[model samples]
Each structure stands twice: as C-alpha cells, then as structure tokens.
Target chain A: MITITGLQKRFGKLAVLRGIDLNIAPGKVTAIVGPNGSGKTTLIKTLLGLVRPDSGTISLAGVSLNGDPSYREMIGYMPQAGKFPENLTVSEVLRLVKDVRRHSGPLDEALFEQFQLAESLNKPIRTLSGGTRQKLSATIAFLFRPEILILDEPTAGLDPVASAQLKDKICRERDGGRTVILTSHIMSEIEALSDILVFLQDGKVFYNGTLAAMIHSSGETRLERAIARLMEGGDAA
Target chain B: MNTTTVRIIKFEFSDVLRSKWVLIYGLFFFLLTETLFRFGGTSARVMLSLSNVVLIIVPLICIVYGTIYLYNAREFMELMLAQPLRRRSLFGGLYSGLVIPLNLSFLVGVGLPFLLHGVERTAHLQAFSMLLLAGVFLTLIFIALAFLISTAYEDKMKGLGIAILSWLLFSVAYDGVMLSLIYRFSDYPLEKAVIALTLLNPVDLARTLLLMQLDIAALMGYTGAVFELFFGSIMGAAISLAALSLWVICPMWLGLRQFRRKDF
Candidate 1:
C-alpha cells in the first residue's frame, strides 16, 4: 500500500497539486479520472517521484520515499511511450531498462511474446511505428514483475486487439495481488477493470471510494453520468 | 548500482557514437592539425597555432554540442528518471559518456598529426602534452557549463542561444572587455589586478598557460609578461590548471543541484 499526505506542487503561479492526501490499497486496480488540469497526472507523477511535492510525505509499506530512489524498484512505470533513447534498438532499450531495474527471476516475457516484438527488436526506437512503440512500453512495464504498476494512458496508441490484451493483462495482474494505478478518460475501461475510483478536481480529491459507492452517492446509474454529477457538484462548491 | 551507472554510460556512449557527430568532430580536428603542422614548420610553431584554435574552437563546440545533445535527450532522461536509478548515477553516467568520447576524438584527431609530424624532442613532447591537457580541461569546463545552462532553461532554442551567447561572452567579448579595461586603467599598478581578472575568464587562463609552455610568454600580447612575473612558470601553470578545474567543478556542482530538483 502507498500512502500520501498533504502533497502540494506548484508550477510558477499555477498550483498543480494542492494538498492531496490519498491511500492506494494493494491487490486492486485504482483508476484516477478527472477533467483536464484536474491534477490527476500530477498526483500520479508525485507518487512516481517525478514531481517533487513542496510539502508532503509519501510512504510505501511504512517507509518514507523522501530522498531515496531505491523504493522505485518495486514500481513499474509506463509513461506515454513517446520517449526512448532514439538511437538504441528496441531490444537494446529493453536491456537497458532491465539492467537499471536489475530484477532477477525466470523473467516475465509474457507480454513480450504476446506482442510479438521479435520482428522489430533490431530496429531503433525512432524507426518504430507509434503502435509498435506502445506495445514495447507495455511489454517493459510487465517485464520485471513489479509489485506496483503505474501506466499513464496505457492504451493510447494501441490497436483494438492490443488494447483488449492489455486490459486482460491488467485484470490478471490485479487478481494476482499487484497494485495497479492507471489514469484514463475512458469511463467504461475504469468501470470494467477498476476496484477503486479516485476522482480528482482542482488538485484535491473530489471523491475517493469504490465505483459502487461513487455511483450511489451521485444518484446516477452509469459511470459517465455519475462522474459528471460529481464534477458539477465540485464546480458548484 | 555501480553496474547500473556503467550500463547507462555504455548505452549513452553507444547511442552517441552511432550518430557519427563525434567522428565528424574528430575529422575536423585532424584536418586542422595536419594543415597547421604542414605550414607552421616546427612542432613549436604548430603547437602554438593549435593552442589558439583550442582556445576558441574547443569551448564553442563542447558547449554547443553538449547543450543540443542534452535537449534532445531530455525525454530519454525522463524515461531513466522513472526507473529505479538515482539521480547521481544517471548524471555520472551521462557526464562520463559525453566527456570521454569528446576527449578521445580530440586526442586522436590532434595527437595523430603531432606524432606524424615527429614531435620526438623532449621539449616538444612536453609542450604537446600540455596542449592536450589544456584541451581536456577546456572540454570538461565547457561541458559542465553546457549542462548548467541546459538544466536551467526548458526551451531548446532558449538554451542553445544562451549557450552560444555564453561562449561568445567567455571567448570574444571577455577579451574585448579586458583590453578596454587595460586601456582605461593603464595608469594603475595593474599586475596583480590583471592576474586576478584572468582567473575569472577560463579562456584567458588557458591561453596564458599555453603561452608559457611555448616559451613565448611575450606572445600573450596583453602584458601577460607581468602575469609570468607574478609567479614562477611551474607554479603559474599549476595555478592556472587548478583554476580550470574550478571552472569544471563549480558549474557542474551547481548544475547537479538544479538537476536533482528539476521537475522532469
């Protein structure tokens, strides 16, 4: 479990994360959804230690993440898959990440095989198509058997088949006792996969609970309408 | 973790090497050194000419290339930052990867011409080594300055412009300013004051060091004779080297501090 307390971050005059407090449970899929500029990505970046919070403390399993990077070992992060060392071949990039993580086991190449990345392993990342690069990102995220997975727009460039496969993979990982935190605008994706709903608005947690509870509170039958109701409530307040 | 640092260094080096910019940089130096040796006659003359080139070209290329490369690799750096790597390890690896390859290309490009031109005499060899040392020091200093600039600005055009402008400030504008200062203050006993000012500009210090090695301290052309008179040659050379080292360490230290707290 990851716990964050009073996290705050500002970019120049605009505050991105204003005193966010949250607890992410293990063995569950938590989908963070919000409107544009609602601090969803900022919250995830703080948890990933990408953005340094001005006033906050983050603890993973009771140990503080302050000034320590080794804690990231258990966390597998897949950003938008847009950036790779452009000169490196796909396989070389994979090896570099593997070397960085230094995870030892039988190795988790399940997604690698599923994606059929062998054909383009020798090509430099700059030469790969957008969807191919997306596939590579997904493969690497699952490569090390990380206890926690942070995927930012995991299916952004994926094809229909790849998207279905990835959703199944997320479910499998969640059921296998891994903590998965994802941010996506597709409410149906969250409705199908997530156990926890974290709705952020204006850098604060507007609502944090199960989707059932969220729907019940909003008096809406559907996930999209329920979130809309909550957003209206937030705007009114 | 040490192994991880090594891996990053290895990755960055290979990626940069494949780009072949270093090879082109090497070729430029090789041609310049060869042409200088052919016309300048003696090893002493060639070394002196090359020192001038080093004083101008080394810092310009190092700073420009370093800044451009840093801006291009910013995204890749974010990828690494998300990994389980410490900021220092990533930095150490990148610094080594960039500084080492650039220095090697420089050494080979210039060293070959010097060797082929038969720099076999003891004095010539010593001065040649000193020239190489100056190049290495300038490389370290300028690359660190590049990192400092690149980390401070997020826009590529802004960072590149500032980097080139900084090179101009250090290499060209600085000398112009110093010359006017001397004319304006020629009445004062400015020996110690001029020496102190030289310490502030790394390019002048490097040139002074090279001039002393060439046994033509008078060629400094700016009353650098008094700088020589301020201290013995050996002591003076050591002091200049230490100052260049400070040039490397100070900006690098500040840059690393900025990098640690960087948003990306």
Candidate 2:
C-alpha cells in the first residue's frame, strides 16, 4: 500500500502539488483524473521519487520514501511519453533493465506474446512507431510484477485493441495483490479501469473515492461530468 | 553492494566501449598523441617535454570521457538509481571504470613507446608513475565537474557547452592568466610568483610536477626551484599527491551531494 500525506511540491512559486493527501490500497486500480497542468504527472513523478516534494512525506508500507530510494525497487514507472535511448534495440533496452534488476528470466510472457514484441525485438527504438514504443514500455513496466505500478497516459498512442489488451494486463496485476496508479485524461478509460477515483485540479485533491460515488455525488452518470463538477469547486462554487 | 557498484561501472564502461562516439574519440586521441610525438622533434629537450604535454592532455581526455560518459548513461543512471544500490557504490564504480580503461589506453598509446626506445629504465618507470598519478587526479576532477554540470543542466547541449567552457578556463585560458601574472610581476621575486600561480592552478601544478619528474626544470630558467621544493623530497611528493587527491575527492563529494538532492 502507498500512503501519501500533505504532499507539497513547487517550481519557483508555481505550486504543483499543494497539501495533497491520498491513500492507495493494495489490489486496486487508482486512476487520477485531472485537467491539463493539474499536477497529474508531477504527483506521479514525486511518488516515484523522480521529483522531490518540498514539504510533504510519502510513505510506502510505513516507511518514508523521502531519501530511501531503495523503495523504488518495489515500484515500476512508465512516463507519459516514455523516453529511451534511440540507439538501443528493443531487446537490448529490456535486457539492460532486467540485468540491473537481476531478473533476467521468468518474465510473464502474456504481454510478450500478446503485443507480438518478439518479432521487433531487434529493432532500434527510433524505428518503432509511437504505439509500438508504448507497448514496449507497458511490457517492461509489468515485467517485474512490481507491488506498485505508476503509469502516466499509458494508452495515448495505443490502438483500440492494444489499449484493451493493456487494461486487461493491469487488471490482472491488481488482481494479483498489486496496487496500480494510472493517470489519463480519457474519462471513459478511467471509468472502466479505476476502482478508486482521485480528482485533481490545480495540484490539490479535490475529490477522492469510488467511481460510482464520484458519479452519484455530482448527480451525473458520466465520470467526466463528475470530474468537471468536482473541479468547479465541488458544489461550493 | 560494492560488487553492485563494480557491476554498474562495468556496465557503463562496456556500453561506452561499444559506442561509435567513444570509439571515434579514442581513435582521435590516439592519433592526436601520435602526431604530437612524431612531429614534436624540434630538439631532444622538446621530445623530453612529452611529460608536460601528457599532463595537459590527461584532463582533456577526462573531460571528454566523463562528459560523454554521463550524457550517454542518462537512462542507465536512472535505472541504477532505481535499483537497491547506494549512491557511493555507483559513483565509486563509475569513477574506477572510466579511469581504468582510459588510463590503460593512454599507457598503450603513449607510455609504452616512450619506455621502449626513448628513455632510460628508471626514467621511464618514473614517467609512467607520474602519468598514472596525473591520470587519476585528472579523471577524478573532470568526472566530478562533468557530473556537476550534467546535474545542473537538463538540456544536453547546455551541459556540454558548460563543460567545454570549464575545460577551456582550466586549460589554455588559465595558462594565459599565469603568463600575464608573470609579466605583470616581473619586478617581484619570480620564483614566488611561479609558486603562487602553480598553487592556484591544479593543471599547472600537475604539469610542473611531471616536468620536474622528467628533469626538464632547466628549460624554465631559475624558476625551477619553485617546483623542486614541491616535487624534490619524498615529503614534498607526498604533500603534492595529498593535495591532488583532495582535488579528486572534494568536487566529487559535492557533485554526489547535489545529485542526491536533485529532482531528476
């Protein structure tokens, strides 16, 4: 389980995450839905320790993740636009990751077979399409079966079938007693995938709970309308 | 954990070894050294001045090697940090890895030839030891500087620009400043002025040390005693080596600290 409390981050007077708090349970998919520049990526990066929090503490399983980077081993991260070395072949990049982790074999082959990455393993990353690169990233993120999976805009370049295939993989990881925190601007994807919905606006958690509760509280059936209502000040505005 | 550091260093070295850029740089350096050696026969004294030339070139290799090393290993560094390794281990590993292969190549390209046909056995051994020491000091200093610059700039071009500018300031520009100071202080005791200048510049200090070891101090006139005081006695050598080691370590510690606090 990942527990974040009073997480505050800023970039030269531009506050990104301001006094944000959230609890992510194990065996559940938590999707953070927010507008553009709403600190979705910042929050995820901070959680992964890529960005430092100015004034808050992030605890994973009762230990503070402030300085102890070893906690990251239990976490797997996929950036919004995942960047890898353009010169590296797909298989070479994965091998580097696996070698670092010393988990070279015993990878779950479901995505490997499903995405048909076997054929293109020798291709340089620069030659791969955006969708194919995303597939490679998704497979690597799930390769280790990390206790915490943080994916940012995972399906942005994915085809409809590939998107569906990835969602199925995420669901399986969650079902296998892992916590997945995914961020996407797509309302339909969040509604389909998220058990817990975190609505963020201007770097603060405006609302947090189940997707059904988010829909019902705003008196709206759709998740997007609920997010819009919550961002417009949660009935106070 | 130390082994993990070694592993990281080994991986970085191997990856860099396979890079076309690294290969190109290595070949360029080898050719540069050979050209200098082949064309540098103005006098026996000039041929003997290879030690000072090597001192200057050592840091250049370190700068180029280190700047490219960190830049190319961006993804790998991130991956390593995400693993269970400590900051010190990774750093130590990288430091040793870059130093070993680079110094070994320098020995092969420069040291062997100088030893084989050019110098006496004892002189060759002293020259080799001096080059190794110079390599260590230069590698440590430049790698730390490169790491600090790499961490400071998110843009690759900006970081490279900063690194090259830094190298210039320490190398040619620094020599210019020392020359100007000597000219300006021509009335003063020249030896004191030289000592002050060498103390101020690590590269010059290294050059002076190597020159003194090669017994070419007479070329610089009466100002040679300034270096002799620092390189003549065992105690003096120990003190100079200690100072060089400090130069190696302090910047690295600062760079590592900055990296630890860095958001990226």
Top-scoring candidate (TM-score): 1
Model 1 has a DockQ score of: 0.81
The segments of candidate 2 whose C-alpha lies over 4 angstroms from its true place after superposition are A234-237, B24-47, B115-118, B189-196, B221-224, B229-235
lDDT of each: 0.88, 0.74
Worst 10 residues of 2 chain A by lDDT: A99-108
Best-matching candidate per DockQ:
1
In candidate 2, which residue pairs get closer than 3 Å at backbone N, Cα or C atoms, i.e. clash?
none
Supply the TM-score for candidate 2. 0.90
Q: What level of docking quality does candidate 2 show?
A: medium
Candidate 1 CAPRI grade: high
